[model samples]
Target: MRYPAVAGMFYPSNPHELIEMIEHCYMHRLGPKDMPSLGCYEKPIGLICPHAGYVYSGPIKAHSYYALSKRSDPMEETTVVILGPNHTGLGSGVSVMDDVWKTPLGEVEADKEFVNLLWRECEIIDLDETAHLNEHSIEVQLPFLQHLEMLNIIKFKIVPICMMFQDYETAVEVGYFIAKIAEELNRRVVIIASTDLSHYEPQEIANKKDMIVIRDILNMDEKQLYEDVVNYNISMCGYGPAIAMMRAMKELGYGEARLLAYATSGDVSGDYSAVVGYSSIIVE
Candidate 1:
């Protein structure tokens, strides 16, 4: 498999260093001083996490994975389906992998049966491995799963979808369809919306914009979320995926969402002039 794009720049090319870094991040927890435990659930439906680098987004990422790990089910029964934005503009719709996705930590085998099943059901799906080649949106979340040991036992498959030519209704429809399949099959699946909030803006402005998006999302108001993005010109990297996740979570019986953590690149780099926002949220 040719792993192209931002391999060395976004993350370390050396396998050992990459593993060490992910492990280190896992060791350090992030969140409120009095954060409550996530506890366990039968089939936790969705997660929204940032896709920034380990240094900038690592703590927030840790909060996400740690919450996931706190769930009751053993790792073996969990199936992770990651939906991310298409930064490369290569794949127009959903793209599923036919083989294992290799990272510096190790290889994550694609659940071929599920991938094919999705393609058969969804008209907009395709088998395009190249779509994932250079996309850090999906890759950045792998190490967190790996460090939690969820990678080894979980019967997980990655569906790297790039939403294009689709509206909020389309995202809702697709999300409901996936939820129906999971219910019918009696499978425990987890959906992850890989995204970041506002892009390069002053810290204060970025915070304001991100809060608007977050409020809409927490209220389960997909239309308001879209409107806020369009009205404010908020450049959130994963708005499509976030909309889809909200739709799917509602279908799967989750009625509430809580913001787990929120921060920005400025918090890490100490630069307030230009910053990108990061947030971790859970649907329950």
Candidate 2:
């Protein structure tokens, strides 16, 4: 079984506290002030969320989750395939966990059948726990999903894939593999790519650099997004997952993307000297 590593740190360890934190995030809705009314769209197929602490990035992440919650009803079958960066540099290049994730709320069972399908489809993807054991990127997303489940907005399973090698080709391969599998299974799956933007830079610089990444995301240019981040030296942690999500959306005939929110830690701490950037996006 996989255990919570960042509990009580990144977020609350107590169930009640965690729920309250997430609720507060949703209610607060901190980020870009001039956001246009998020109109209805086709069923959400993917999301790009941040993985920072709730106090820093939770509000941005909430925008994506709240938008998705609005779309999910009790009648639909949803499976969330969460792809997170492997921050600890452990395990295989692409690690897939086949075990229950123990959170303070309860146990979230891994989708073994989907894991097996991905393992069979990709040589780079492996069934391993080392990457997940000490990683927070994937772990942080679970509680938000659990909160959604608790609200009865959506009941869904999860397939958590952690990536240590975030490269252009790897992202594409992973994305197309997921697209093929979902089609084969005739399932409705949402790919949630967890990432944080430029780290420890001035707020203005962070926003400028993150916009480069966000522009490609909005344009649905996966290769350009991947290349621009690397070439420009933008320190986006989950560009690989973002590219993969974009590719998967493209494969599924999704051509539109919506920018939900963007902000920096300085917005919270009131220290604009050096801060991490956060953003939330949806690709449909």
Candidate 3:
């Protein structure tokens, strides 16, 4: 079993506290005022969300989950493929974890079949659990998913991938293969790229710098995004994962992306001198 890595740190360890914290996130001033509603039928292909502490980035993450819950139909056979940057440098350049993930809400089963298939077909993707053992980027995302599951809004098996290398070449290759295999198998896939933008910069500078990368994402230009990251030194932590998820969407014929919300840690802490920018964007 993959135990919770950031359970007590990033979020609450107690199950009750965890649930309340998630609810508070939904009701936060920056978050979507109302709870998730199954009002639409168009499924989302990909999303870009910030992976930070609940007090800092959870509201921002809520925006993405709210967008996810919009699909009116039940997500029966859906697989959530989460791609996060390897902050801890513990495993392969591109690694996938095949194990049941435990969270406060309950245990979520990994899509072993999906893992096995991708490992065989994608030469660059290695099966490694060490990368995820101490990585909070992917683990922090589970509570939101677990909250959604508790609501019976969706049911899914997850396939977690950690990218230690966020280079353009590796990201593009990984994204391409994920879409390729899912399409071949006729499987429904929803991708979530875990990221935070413009870390520890002044609010004004962070917004300006992040906007450049955000524009590239909204335009669905992964190459230009990489360029923006490199040329501007944007400090976006998960650009590689974003690039990968964007590539997968493009492969699956998604052309447009909508920015649901954008905010900074300063907004919550009232410390504008230096802050981390977070955004929630969904691809349609």
lDDT per prediction? 0.74, 0.86, 0.90
Error of 2 at 158 (Å): 0.6
Tens-digit lDDT string for candidate 2 (174-259): 99988888778876788999999999999888999999999999999998998899788999999999998988888888868989
Clashes of 2: 0
lDDT of 1 by residue, 147-219 (tens): 5553332345555565653467767766776677667666677888889999999999999999999999889
Question: How many steric overlaps does candidate 3 have?
Answer: 0
Which pairs of residues collide in candidate 1? 40-72
lDDT of 3 by residue, 1-284 (tens): 99998889999999999999999999999999879866444554799999999999999999999988876346565788999999998989999988999988889898888888888899989999989999999899988887887787877889999999999999999999989878877777889999999999999999999899999999999999999999998999999999999999999988689999999999999999999999999997
Task: Tell me the deviation in Å of residue 30 in model 1.
Answer: 4.8
Instruction: Supply the global lDDT for candidate 2.
Output: 0.86
Q: What ranges in model 1 sit over 4 Å off?
A: 1-5, 27-41, 150-155
Off by over 4 Å in 2: 29-44
Question: What's each prediction's TM-score?
Answer: 0.89, 0.95, 0.97
Error of 3 at 91 (Å): 0.8
**Best model per lDDT:** 3
Off by over 4 Å in 3: 39-41
> Highest TM-score among the candidates is held by which one?
3
